[model samples]
Target: MDTTTHVAQTERRRTSPPAGSAGPSAGADPRRGPKRLSPRMRKLTLLIHVIAAVSWLGLDVGLLTLSVTGRISDDPETIRAAYVAMDVFGDVLLIPVALFTLVTGVLLGMGTRWGLLRYHWVLTKLVLTLVAFTATVAALRPGLEQAARDALRTPPEVGAAASDVLVAPCVALALYTFMTVLSVYKPWGMTRFARERLGRPGAHGAARGK
Candidate 1:
């Protein structure tokens, strides 16, 4: 072959994509973002998350009922028993369930396209969950313990501790319900971070490149 022909053929081979390939932009673009969870794994994590959240709500309801009973009942024995049960439930069930819910929720947020802070609803949920978890550890459990101690006293005087137990659970229940609604409706649009990221040059192309 002529030297010029040989150089031209080599140049074509170097420039051309391999057979049946669509060149560099053909598949998922690594620049777009990190990989998400597999569909099945995501579903499994979601299931666990739902169960944990429901369980936490249920525990809160149970605690609220006990608190009301302890506060309203005239019988000293009944009040003591109710308060003791509340303490046990708080220590053995409530804290663990709240932690589980938080962990699973964070996992789902980070593992899926929704992202932890990419959307307003998701960010709100994360903030609320953190608040709830902190309250459970810092306030609710201590209140329950104080109420239990007051109930067990010789005179069985719960005093202001009774109100604390009742109020904490009421607030927690409200927060959980609101968070659940947020999950269902997913109101509000993307967060500022998401909006800014999407606005950057080649963002759409990178997304489509995936």
Candidate 2:
């Protein structure tokens, strides 16, 4: 080949991308960072989600403390007070905060690029939150109310009889703590759905092109 033709062919080889590769950027893990929420309403919804989640966790901590106190205390008045406080906290604070947190989390996931079933960590957090909330309402709340009633009887018995209340809060506390950690770290990679969506020719490439 002539010198000019050889140089042109070399240039073409240099510029051409390798076959079957989406390039370096596409190889990155989809769970690396969150997409920015630009809109005011999305930001507000995320803020509410954070607030409600933190409040729910704090309330679980309070309930755990009350459970320990009720379990250990021999004095009927102390036991009664602890169980009553648990009942009141559950009705007034825990239930409301848990429901709000769940709803806001769903909204945030739906409205943002971090979709409901996209990231593995997000999906795990959603499931854990749902299970925790369901258990709190169906099992823990009723158990607390019953424990409070039993504690108010002539001879209060909140020791082993109310063990469910104690154990339930401990489980909830652990679950909530794990969920919080998931929010902060987001350790796992993307789900299959996320990969499929992000790997589309126009969708992901269009953003990078801009």
Candidate 3:
């Protein structure tokens, strides 16, 4: 009886999984794993992001020009045309563009190896983007509307505002490139990520590796 028990226990031990082996289909869990990004999907996402950003800049230019010009003919018809363009552009171009950029940006940040919390540039852009979004929705739109209203009624010199408008894209483009640099170079000044996973390594480790 004792010999039989020992043999049975040895057989069971032999049949058991090795250390760190996840049984039959090791590391095959549906959860806690990565979903692969198809190349077409990536290209489409990039197209949408770039196009939408360009549209936002272009649409702003149109509206800015119309609002700034004092001699745009205050005939109800002309004003209606201006407002119509503004409304159409805002409803169609602006909202969708901004939404796509924000959504895609978030996905690109989190769904990749970087996981959003790792990189310094992505981290900085994350902060800057919040401010930019707030400014666009909470401040820029209102400011533009008030400026338009004032432009319609009073003959004020808003060359300063218009000048900013012309330069805004350049500033934004520069800042965006700066964000990209932060993503690429990842020069560290702030507190580290509680690990040495800055820039791409953080992303890579989070996505790949054991």
Candidate 4:
């Protein structure tokens, strides 16, 4: 071939995308994201996440009940017992619930059409769960320890300002309840990321054609 023809061919090869990437959207884009999970794996993850969430809520209810009982009961022994139980449950049950729920939900999101940032509701839930987890670690567990220690003191009486031992659990219950409702309703519209992908020209139509 002539020098001119050779130069033109090289330019075309360099400019054109590699084979199998000529469509509207290519996998090379970071935003294109990862592939979804199989239906079986998705269902399994959802089941685990649901169980962890419900268990967390139930444990919080137990803590709340103990708190109320300790607050109303005049007996120091009852109060001490309640605080100790709270400590044990918090350590043994609540921590695992929080960690498992967070991990499973993240996996579920990544492995489904609901990319973590794709929907407003999903994003909100992720934020709330993270916040709840942070509170569990930074404040809730430590506060439980403090309350347990205070209850074990010489007098064995609940402290005058021991309301937190009662209040934190109640707040956690409410927070978890809200999260559950969000999961059910999923009311919010698509997030910016989802809109961009599922928007104009119907690029995602094939993948989401169900």
Candidate 5:
């Protein structure tokens, strides 16, 4: 009888789940869903992303100021200085900061529930960032360089490139401001792809129900 009882206990132990283990259904599948960052890492990434974005915005504002000064100032030295400063900012700081902002934003989207294509706001921001980055590299930088060259000429004049240098920053500033508001408000709901991928109602649905 004791041997029979011992055998039964052994079988029970073999059949039972290990202590503290969750059932298969209780946790997410590692193979599925977006990869998540640890809470600390997420916070760090968010901080960096915000800093980079703000820096980009600040740079835009500075460029706008310089462009305006270069365009309107009668003093040759002042105009030359403004355009030179604009060129320097564009050459040394602008692209790197924009790149950092874009990369960090992408990382945050991929590493969190927000996801790259999950929501309208995120998608819009991504598109805007890409457009701004491309314009800065392709159009804005060249315009700044040309303006600086024009300013450095014997007469130090504002030329065709002046309009581009001024307008680009204004557009970029507006876009960045809009994107900032979007981040705060997050107005739109999830995309159709996200809804289908999640296989359930998303945050908007949950909020409405609440």
Candidate 6:
């Protein structure tokens, strides 16, 4: 008679999450992180960027329209209204839009493998975006605010012309247009650093990706 042998298979088991996980299961894949962004959050970020860009563009267009409609510095009341409108657009919307656009565009760009600083086009876009952002803060916003404050002192009709009102708006619109073109054409060639770093896995990913 042959002796029969029995084997016991021990299954490996996972430990429960430490109370400190804060809520997520400890066994969850750590690499995936918290899945910090939901479908909703991603959509929201994209929407915010779109809205901000449109707002910036629309503000420029609105100012131009006012000029075309003969609303600049000619009438006292119109000038005052323009002042209020610009301030509202600036304080309430434009600044926020700009900040959100800049931040979100950066985050989105970095998050994707497309890479923000690697390719020439992305680099150029980044430079232009920063330039546009700085110009808005330093030149554009100040000019509008000054126009408003000056409106307080200067006659509604003082030193005013359609050209005067349209000038800043047109300039801002041009920047916006340039930005849009860069986005569409992305004409930047390639960054030397990026080419050198190309073989590296996710340098851009390291910069932007979690």
**Candidate 1 global Cα RMSD:** 5.3
Better of 1 and 5 by TM-score: 5
Show where candidate 4 strays beyond 4 Å: 1-35, 197-210
Residue range 100-204, candidate 1, lDDT tens digits: 999999999898778888888999999999999998899888988999999999879878888988998899889988998998899876666775775655554
Candidates 4 and 6 compared: the better one by TM-score is 4
Estimate every model's Cα lDDT from 0 to 1. Answer: 0.87, 0.83, 0.56, 0.82, 0.90, 0.64
lDDT of 1 at 168: 89
Q: Which has the better lDDT: candidate 1, or candidate 4?
A: 1
Of 1 and 3, which scores higher on TM-score? 1
Tell me the tens digit of each residue's lDDT in model 3 across 37-119.
46677667667767765666576667665544433454644554454455455545665666666677776666654445655
lDDT of 5 by residue, 1-210 (tens): 699999999999998889888755678552245558989999999999999999999999999999999888999999999999999999999999999999999999999878888888999999999999999999999999999999999899798999889999999989999999999999777777777766664645775787
lDDT of 3: 0.56
Q: Model 1, which residues run further than 4 Å from truth?
A: 1-35, 200-210
Candidate 2 lDDT tens digits, 85-124: 9999988988899999999999888777777898889899
lDDT score for residue 65 of model 6: 70
Score residue 123 of candidate 4 by CA lDDT.
96
- Tens digit per residue, CA lDDT, model 6, 1-210: 333322222221234444556444445532222334566876787788788788878977876775454353467777677665765676677677777778887765665444676567767667777887887787767666666666566565434433455577787788778878877886745455755554544445565555
TM-score of 2: 0.75
Off by over 4 Å in 6: 1-43, 67-73, 160-165, 199-210
As a whole number from 0 to 100, the lDDT of residue 138 in candidate 3 is: 61
Estimated TM-score for each candidate: 0.81, 0.75, 0.55, 0.77, 0.81, 0.65
Alpha-carbon RMSD to native, per candidate: 5.3, 9.3, 7.7, 5.5, 5.6, 9.8
